[model samples]
Target chain A: MVAKRTVSEVGEFGLIGRFTEGRVQPVSTLLGPGDDAAVVAAPDGRVAASTDVLVAGVHFRLDWSTPEQVGRKAAAVNLADVAAMGAVPTALLVGLGCPPDLPADVAEQVAAGLWAEASRVGAGVVGGDVVSAPALVVSVTVLGDLRGRAPVTRAGASAGEVLALAGRTGWAAAGLALLAAGRETPPGPVAAQRVPEPPYRAGPAAAEAGATAMIDISDGLLADLGHIAEASGVGLDVRSSALPVPPELAEAAAELGADAVSWLLTGGEDHALAATFPADAALPDGWRVIGRATPGAAVTVDGEPYAGPAGWTHFT
Target chain B: MVAKRTVSEVGEFGLIGRFTEGRVQPVSTLLGPGDDAAVVAAPDGRVAASTDVLVAGVHFRLDWSTPEQVGRKAAAVNLADVAAMGAVPTALLVGLGCPPDLPADVAEQVAAGLWAEASRVGAGVVGGDVVSAPALVVSVTVLGDLRGRAPVTRAGASAGEVLALAGRTGWAAAGLALLAAGRETPPGPVAAQRVPEPPYRAGPAAAEAGATAMIDISDGLLADLGHIAEASGVGLDVRSSALPVPPELAEAAAELGADAVSWLLTGGEDHALAATFPADAALPDGWRVIGRATPGAAVTVDGEPYAGPAGWTHFT
Candidate 1:
């Protein structure tokens, strides 16, 4: 194998060129990279926007995952926010900070990973900035179009509304448990921890199906649901039996002598969409009714307060 | 003075609440913070977008400048990119990563500075994320509306077009010189380096005036202009005598026994707008013609190749 070139050897502009060369932009991109700013078509009267930052060691360890995984995880988290807003993601702006001594190929893998994941949502990388720092920091800001639909915010849930969820939960947390326990777990949970593929389409579907409120589970389910409950001035009563716990998570939890229910309730970063709808509303496919919203501000599991972790807090 | 609370004490969620609580939003904000994502009005069909990252120590030193200055500078730099596209800025999404040990007030000041600078252009802070990191990293992504006008891009310049600038030059570079030389300098240049105030409205004005090509002077005059020349496939012949050299820059150069012309040519972070226009077009009030787009690929000063520094490079 040939030796790889380093970022310091090619410089910032050179690395940028490598990332942008021959890139095919999506139809929403009015003006792509190479300019001071990219022009993206926000056909709707309003544009939904969100941002997230991932730092090395704190967010992800470079040794455990590839740069590609890191890139995909960053893009997925940001896109998940747009989805949670009941919007279709259109574009992304990535701001990458890496040490100069890093291999150019590593940065390329990161950019490639960004493209690969963006293509999953049919969005494109519209603009970015590259800077030198002591460690790798990936910051992604996503833009989405609401398509004339009102945003499904956390404040819209009403008492007596049915609480529902789409996609897997607690899998990522179980994967984290495995990684922490230093045990060889199944590939499914481990991959879930490394690269989260949020149910992007479920957001728009829930909106079309008349979702009253929605939020992406970046923090644990209990922690995130608590946010919705507080914002909507309602209590979320989650049914412990309704959660779809995958076999891999259960197996991993059993091996680690941990409770899978705790992971299901408090797992964060799964990028699952939790939403509320009218009691009699017809639910869309992949959405499972979990419980109901009640008056007051609390999130309880199985008619009782959850006693496990409150959720992942950036600073504890 | 009372002892200030640290970020770790307040925790990430608490600090976020403090920064967002009771905040005033601009007219363009349809949905502000506290949701899955913020929605901003995009009256025009297209939105110009850009992202930039500023790492502590690499981009700014906390000992030399206040957190407010860093926040303002971050907002200004990102807004300048939107301005460079000849679009009206609409909203900003900030992603902040800092150590948990940082003072809570310092983070608040950073957010406040972002708000202060964003208000200058009538834009609102739509959304953001805060994460824990080893050091402070502020990443800002700005969105802009073209208002039915075509985006001014770097690839539109033509040979024989007049090259003009709408803001001051070399001030930030001069300020950096004073800081590096450990000399006591006036507040003007030092402030310029700390918080750049680019002519934001001038971007739309230049666009209305039919600017053919445009770029922000973040990477020094010669270096950034070189980008326009290379992208437009034209030579830029800058008249050295016509280049704007502020008085403070000259004084600082004299005190340091450095050539002021070098600073004027190669200074970065000034965030000045440079564009190419029809030679016969009536220039706007703040814009001054300092050069002409020529028929070759080289950027010349006074018809000769510049021999000074080629501006900043993130990596060696």
Candidate 2:
């Protein structure tokens, strides 16, 4: 039988080595892991950056979500933010907090998630610090490159531009609903909720196609789009009929007695790409035109007040 | 009379706006807050990055230290890591998790600390995310520029190289001991534990001097030096009498029945720069020669085995 090793036995430095060993870094990275900080090539002379923190019992649960899921989601959410800037992710630094009793494999799983998502975005988990916490908390910071393209901002949308989405919405919310139902899962909506596969490439694609304004659908579709509207000083109009409710969402909503339309309009964490393009520009594949940028400050849907849920507000 | 609003009153967006208002961004940053991610100039074709997370009870106590202290400590630690990579500080991304009932002033103080420390390193807090948690946790990610200098790593130390240190050691541990002893008002050593002043410029100076290997003594002088020895496959010999023990540490150690030399050797949080230099190299002004690198895996003092504390180990 193998003797069990505790973190205290090896110490933080030894454990850090165990957690970071075999991790590959990009060629442009001058340093990785074992140094004070990791250096990565940023030849573009600019970097796009963002940070997100996930707390246990709020953002995730140890019982419901595996450590790998928690780690992936923690990293994926931050990467999505960077991608929303119309940049390619280059590197990430992670701050992890967990109880002392937490298994070493759990930490490794979290790292696995971070590694997988980072690889998906053509980036690497370059550097990080791990410490003890009262509860599991994962904090991730992403550094990205614009690759010489203009960054799409929320304040650039002009009147008459087409408001569109390039990724699926309401899928994660539907997954949540399924999870709430306590149904043993398979390849279903709940699974998607566990791991949100963001429309990572669409951000750069939109930048390439001259997208004027952009934001990620983390805080519901209407709410985040509203941010662009307010920042750009423009009005937004959504055709309610244009809402893309995944079939799984309709099924879950029907079973849960929740309105699927509300889920499509206000549910968040789908990581769908929302942006405004010049009316004359060609639309990219998988993108659906859902609305138009107008000359007011309000967000309207289908020329009427179709209120189910507005959006998510922090500290509410 | 206008009533001060709680975070719940205006909600998350309003709080974010308040935090971002009156803040000026650097010219290198193309985009700031209120966006999906912040865009900053990363000239030199590369970016240096590091991250750290500080928990309220474990890392900092609200009763003992102000929120600003927490913020400064949080950002300072990450920035110190970046500085360790022989890079110029550029920008920071922050992730904060707190309870809904946390006062807005507390958040402001934290932000003020973050901004103050960031400015000290010639960088700006470019973007952040605020979320709900059961406890207060601050995570900061810093990005830096190498300015075309090759990063010095721990693996490059060679036999016959002189080991030198560029900052004080054991100050924080002395402060911590004072704090634990109910000596809340320790004259100098106490504050040192609250906020360590790392020798920020020494890293770049070492890089410019073509130092072969480097590390920041965050986890005690001897413990962190052990990292260099293990990484470079060499033995190190430390001199007890050469240690730069602050007068306050010596005074406090006497009262606590501890030896200042042991603390100087094994205490941590000094964030001093330690490096291995060629035998014939000219040493910088601030650096002091404390040891020599030799072929082997052992670390000794004065050509003999020195029985002393081995420094801190996490979860131990």
lDDT of model number 2: 0.82
Writing each residue's lDDT as its tens digit, candidate 1 over A94-152 gives: 99998888899899888988988999999999999999877889999999999999999
CAPRI-wise, candidate 1 is high
- The residue-by-residue lDDT of candidate 1 on B1-316, one tens digit each, is 9877888889988988988887899889999999889999999767899999998999998987899999999999999999999999989999998788899999999999999999999998889999887789999999998989999999999998999998888888888888877765966888898999899999999999999999999999999999999999999988988975678787888888887788888888989999999989999878999999999999999889998788998887
What is candidate 2's lDDT per residue for B42-119, written digit by digit as tens? 777888888888888877778767888788888877777767777777888888887777877788789888988888
What residue pairs clash in candidate 2, if any at all?
A41-B45, A41-B46, A42-B45, A42-B46, A43-B45, A45-B42, A45-B43, A46-B41, A46-B42, A175-A189
Chain B TM-score of every predicted model: 0.98, 0.93
TM-score of each: 0.98, 0.95
Against the true structure, candidate 1 reaches a TM-score of: 0.98
Q: What is the interface RMSD of each candidate, in Å?
A: 0.9, 1.9
DockQ of each: 0.86, 0.70
